[model samples]
Target: MRVLSRFKASTIRRWLLAVGAAAVDPAGVLVCAVLLWLGTAGLCIAMLLVSREDAYHQAIQVGRNLTLVLERDIVRSVELYDLSLRAVAEGAANPSVMSLPKELRNQVLFERPTTARYLGPITVYGPDGTVQACSIETSIRRTHRPDVRWFITQAEKTDAGLYVSAPYASRTAGGKIVLALGRQITSPDGKFAGVVVGRLSIDYFRELLDGLSVGKQGGMAVIETNGILLTRLPYNRNDVGKDFSHSPVFVRFMKDGAGSFVGTATIDGVRRLYVYRHIHGLPFVVGVAPALSEVYAGWRWRASWVALLMALFTVALAAGAWSLMSELRRRQVARAQLQRMARRDALTGLENRGTFDEVSRREFLRAKRNGTPLSLLFIDIDNFKAYNDHYGHQAGDYVIKRVASRIASRVFRPGDHVARYGGEEFVVVLPETDAGSAVLIAEEIRLAIYELDIKHVKSQYGRVTISIGAASSGEPDTVDEAALIKAADMATYDAKSTGRNRVCWHTASNGLNADEHIKNTEPGDQAHP
Candidate 1:
């Protein structure tokens, strides 16, 4: 009976132990579940954002394709009008092609007995701006041809051939619009005969865009290089000849050489995806907008199903992870570390090239809008390859890291950045800094690196040196990250060409008209032998 009592007590102790193991703390479980839920939610949110971005890009491509097709048609139509005008001129000279317009036909066949009715409103003005033949009924009454802006400008700019003016309202014809194409006809002795003026139909463009097979509730838009919207449906029928002065897309469109955008808009009481692109070949922005819901209609059900399934899975996983707080924390740490590694350079702890590019572009735009001077420096280690060849690769890496760190430290300022662009190359962006200040900073960096005293056995001077290219611009219209980079690269090339361990400046103007080549001048550096 005593042994049986001891066995019962032992069995009671084992049962209590099992009960303690199974009775997990509710608070710990709750915390873990919350963490897991947050992590899963974050992952799903990221996926959704990426998917939306992909859709936006795809829509933009489709819009650009449509715009290009429409632009080609517009060009063809304009060319046909131009060709017809040329044919009239040729016929006047050789009596071959086709007949002139109704007005000219009436004058030539039924007019005066003295004058052989002149061809298509030929206006001959001499060097002194005197009218030799004022044949155009519209321009005949004007006393001084030189007073007109188009006439003086065209004559001053070109010596020969046809010059077509963009559509402008004819002030002489009661504000009637006309497309004027001018050809300077020269005499047999090389003197000027006259300017053969041909008229083109203005409503052709408006009619052509109206006929395009744009989707329901979709609009065809055209914008000029100067942020002027030539035409678009629904949003602005009045905008047919109006400029979008306050449109954000127009602002970015003028800046980007050729690209597309997707933005939110409402038309006809429904929201839509406004897809737009800048036509590179034409001085116009062409866009095709389709309802966002319509474009993604086919994928809507699939996306909804996926979202619902993911939500349910997330809930179940959260419930199961309720008791694993430590594991959840561990995973969070791992994810953060991975994200850091992806965005940062392993060598110098600076931003990676891709991240640098994005940051630089943003900074450049901010500077441009603020009308502040921005500068870029492209730096390269002279004889870096030789150094790697002589010393170990480890030593070469050390040099790169050291240089990057120095740059990061020296150019420490708000909106400034230093990055290792690639092997043996580094780029620095200095915001609100001019070319002079940028050159000074570059010299400091160059001298500091030379002070490193790293042996370059293969170098002519048997020492370490760096080549720097510096360029800067304050003109908001001219400055950008790419322009700065190009200027700096050119300066770097000059530094290399003249001699290493020096700072070179691109002395070109904002308009890029100056031919001032790089001037490589710095302390402790001589011209190449």
Candidate 2:
């Protein structure tokens, strides 16, 4: 019972050792690295997406703020123009104001508002679309400006409220494009008598937009809601007064009084982020469009660093995994080599006695349980001592190695075990083999050794040969591993004592007579003496 328990424990321990040896696998490390890389890449992409969204929102906020400031500034400028026009209209309608001297009358008409830079003197055009009064000119220049667009526009409008005209070339302001603000003058009877006008020169808007920076390829613009473009920074003179009613910016993001969007531009196909404010009470929309590339510049820079770091981290991880995997493989190979050295004999490179003992015992128990026979062969190199004395111990050792190789080649069954029993002796354990088969196998091994024909000058045969004693458990239930090895050993002694190169087979039984054990008696089964 104790021996069986020990054998079971030994078997379990060996299996555990085998499992431990397989624990370090390179493929496992590579798989783990790949999973980690996937996780890291997913996280990096998510971070980049979130950061891009944040950048867009920040650009929107910046653009909205800029549009608001511009809107307020524009509103204040228009209010000033309206105030100047009201002053001019009241002066023109009042006889007391007209009766004043030229310089004083001009002061009351436009001097107060003209003190503000970019605000030109108000000009008064009579109902006939002719110039009746001018503040900058010394006298009324009787200018029949009937063909003027601002004059005709004011003449047609019956509403007394302020009117802002489309951008037009000013013959008075050196033909520079100017935006005009006008209001109809009414007589005491409340009929249109004349128009009071103030021209805001392009320099005013140029000065307003000069200090602001949108981007290298981006611009800020003010456009009349009715489709006329007033002005744009990065100013193109040809774009002033251009119709933009069919533009996507006017049709899409121009709704809801205020809006922002990111889209491709129809002009140059460059992508942009547009933020616009339809000045609450005014007819024009103030818009700031920053290049999409500029808006996400910071995010792109930061993402590049983050992606580089992640790539470097992934590379480092891969290198580490590869190095660890290589080290594990190297150790596995070394451990396997050590295990092979531990199990095999140093001289013959075959399973040594210790491994054979454990394997034979296990096979014996297996055969007993299955009711099958087990066989063993004990081999001796005949005349080995004489060969060593005649040649050298090196030749004897060479012969031992050659004999072990022959036995291993012959015992090709997976379950059979060949081992070096001791000096000049070897053992082969043949599982599930009967006495007849064991004797036949032993005869083949003896013949193979005889075929070697190594010189042995001290012996009678003058050649190398081996004696094989093969034994089988005919009654496996009555036999054990010890009895099988003992019987094979006795048979080998019998063969050596009688004649050199021969196979002696024995049917092993516990406590049986040695003579009775030798059952497979062939032609030369006699004692040598």
Candidate 3:
């Protein structure tokens, strides 16, 4: 049985892989599931095919067994007829036995062998082909009259071999069919003297076959090698002596000694699986032909159940695979949330410096490819150290948070980003912004943070304020992420060095001439300086 192939070990490993892959590549789960199902289905089909073939072969073996029993019985009957014919032929040729009284002659030649019901009386026919004597008062059927085939064959061939005639209707009583078994008697000079012939009732063939237990659509037959069907059971009177020479299966029966085949009956077109055996000493072939439907009936029942079970199993497996994939997806969601939490800065609720570093590098490469300006803003609480010492550290943290929120509110663009660059400092990245626009955005943030009016008694402005340094790079290939950050940091130093609470920008000529410096030194703010 190839049933083990229905579920392969390799596909089980793939099912495991599908569960693991849900988090990495969600589509792989569905793809692997489909493959697993296809693999299982292929295995199941292969097993079912092997099983069905096994059932067919077993049926053939069983039919052969039935043919074996049938051939033995029919061959024995033909042999008995031959013996009876030989006895009468030898008695007819003897001068002494021919001269005895009718009762004694009949007693010597036809006592037991001719008395059986299946056997008709044995009779002697002279060289002139007329019946000389018979065991019973009835003579030979004489249906063939002067040109009987058995008499002609016995006279022409001096051989002692029995001539078993093809079936013919007997004129006696009911006009039943009979086979004439003939043997020739020769004189001392080897010339034919007479012949002995015995009649074997064709009814015996059907009666014996009917006793066997073949199913209703099943049958047994004794057929001549030349395709003459002697008798059949599930007995059909019309099918007796029917010629089957045109059938392909019958042609094989003529060519081969014995074998089997599946064929359709021409008269009724009933398809059957036929198993035949050639009786060793006779011209007859015994066949057991059961309907093809009958042969496969048991196999189909088992296969239907097996197929149903396999279908239910596959459905359960698919349902299980989908359920597992769902569980993996839930874990994937949880992992993603934890990952996002890791990327955030705890104090500011903004992306941390690690995210800023990676994002700014990608934006730099994009700007280089598209030939666009990329800008960065480096902001600092100008008097944060002094303010931390003057107010308490708690107030210092409060001021830092307020300044971070104010900067975030001023910078708003879909592709722009902000992150806490380090302690008391934050950085913002603006894509597709020139140095002029970047300075304007930086000035707006500086003014917004200075307007908060948080107290700083120890600093120059004596209030909490911010200094923002702006930098721009149109040629990102020459100035990478490091160069962009350095420029912004130097610009911030320049702003605080002149006076706090201002915005300053540094750039080259086409980018803002490196010597040029722009500031957020508005008229009212200089009075504090």
Candidate 4:
């Protein structure tokens, strides 16, 4: 009886362990399933958006291609018309083709293509828009109404050249649908010859479209401004003669002449994606359509793969987020360090040259606007090269940095900027200070550099010192920043030329404020005698 009770207890413990394991496994699977589902959903949405963008891009590129082809054709047609018009004008001037009266002139002018490559009919018109002659058997005597408009319109306009007329109803002998191309002719002395007009059949453009493929299951159409279907793909007999004025595509093309537009349309009883573009320079709009199924054929399958990858990535990302949080913290610290470095000069801790220039200019303008005196001092180290020679280049750098620190300490106001202009040269801009005060500051800087007592064994001079020039300008309205700098620079040169390690001031007074020399002198500071 004791053994049976022990066996029952063991059986109960085994059953409890099995139940716990089953519960934990299902809970883990449930959490994973949730993450997978969310990731898949997000990937699907992203893929959908990307696919839409791709479709729009493809549509625009195709539209631009169509526009380019049409422009090329238009240019070629104009060139051909130009050549034909010149030929016809030459014939009209020839005495051999000139004997017949104007009515029969067209018939007399008739001649077979001796060149064997002529593509279309060539006709000549008088200045009055009457058909003067033609190579074809057309009745030139009959009032050529279509010829009349193009000739009169182009001849009346002075700047007329080879131009395409808007698609208009043709009244010429062969009254098929047509557009007229004409060129204005003038003699070498600028006398006007009549226009030579050529009729280009629209069917040639249809052949161009037929050769191009937009997408699988895609087709193209060309439409007139009035919504007439001039051509359609697959060479449909019914579409060739029909007008699509009632179509939405035509309505929108008439409204906006450029930019991509998308819509749904029916082709062969199936809904398709339509991308339409308007040709602003032409009299037509071209549109292409691809069946929706073909355009989105692989979209769903690709989306599924993208979703699966995103699911796995999300699981990996979550694990990485927890494990690599320290790296994220490290990146944050690095970004802050970079930002600090961006604003500081790595060589000398003083504000960078760019910062000094900006601040000095602002203060200079402020002092000038208020009619307060502003002064600038340009300082250069004397025989810096000798110092660099005596001690290596690195020692020279230390001397420059030490001198900069000395000058930086002498400036009292926050508005004063001490900047290293270039190697061995420095600048200090003093707002609200006149030439006298600027001279005092320059003397102080000169003394400070001299006090450094940096030994240069290779130098002729015993100790290194700086030569400084001070210029002050009080004429706010008459002075510009460049003039201020020039005055300071000239004073510096004067200081250096007379003697180094000295402060020189430029006085603006002209012995006579002569205009020619006044132009040479700076505001408030006269040239030193």
Query: What overall lDDT goes with each candidate model?
Result: 0.65, 0.80, 0.78, 0.66
- Name the runs in model 2 displaced over 4 angstroms: 1-24, 87-114, 125-134, 138-147, 158-160, 186-194, 253-256, 266-269, 303-315, 476-478, 508-512, 520-529
lDDT of 2 by residue, 1-529 (tens): 9999999999999998866655457776777778889998999999899999999999889999999899899898888678878878977877677678877877677765544677666788888977767877843344787777878888888788888888887767767788888899887878888899888877777778777999898888888888788778778777878998898877864567888887676656778898988987778888899998898889989999998899899889989999999998898798898888888999999998889999999998998899888888999988888788878888888989998898888887898899998999999989889877887788777767767777777766678878888777774433678988887888888777766677776643433346544543333342120
Ranking by lDDT: 2, 3, 4, 1
Candidate 3 local lDDT, 1-529, one digit each (tens):
3555646666787888867755345456667767777887788778778877886788778878888887788777778777777777777888788789988887877754646778887778888887777877665455233367888887888577877788888766357888887888886677888788778888888887888755778777888777888888777888898888787767766767778888886656788888888888778888888888877787778779878987897788778778877877787787886776677777777778889999889998999889898999898888788788878898988887888888889878879998898889899999999888887787778778778888788867767888777887763423788889888887777777767677777755424334343454651343110
RMSD to true structure for each model, in Å: 41.6, 5.9, 8.7, 35.8
TM per candidate: 0.38, 0.83, 0.72, 0.42
Backbone clashes, each candidate: 1, 0, 4, 5
Per-residue lDDT of 114-221 in model 4, one digit per residue for the tens? Answer: 222223577776656666666664535464543456666877768645556655545563555566777675654566656777766666667767788766666677
TM-score (C-alpha, index-matched) for candidate 4: 0.42
lDDT of 1 by residue, 1-529 (tens): 9999999999999998866544444455665566767787788778776776676667667776777787787666545544544443333333211145646653442232122111124444444456544345565666557666556655665565456555566665456444565655444455544444544434555655677754676666666666555556544444444556566656655666556455554224445555555544446566677767766664565578768977898767765664364565676677777776777788888778887788778878887789788888889989888899889899999988888877777786767788878888888888888877888888888878878777778887677788998877653433568777777777787778776788887765423333355567744853220
Rank order (by TM-score, best first): 2, 3, 4, 1
Best by TM-score: 2
Name the weakest run of 10 consecutive residues (lDDT summed) in model 2: 520-529
lDDT of 4: 0.66
lDDT of model 2, residue 148: 78
Q: List the residue pairs that clash in candidate 3.
A: 508-512, 508-513, 508-514, 509-513
Model 1 scores a TM of 0.38
In terms of lDDT, the best-performing candidate is 2
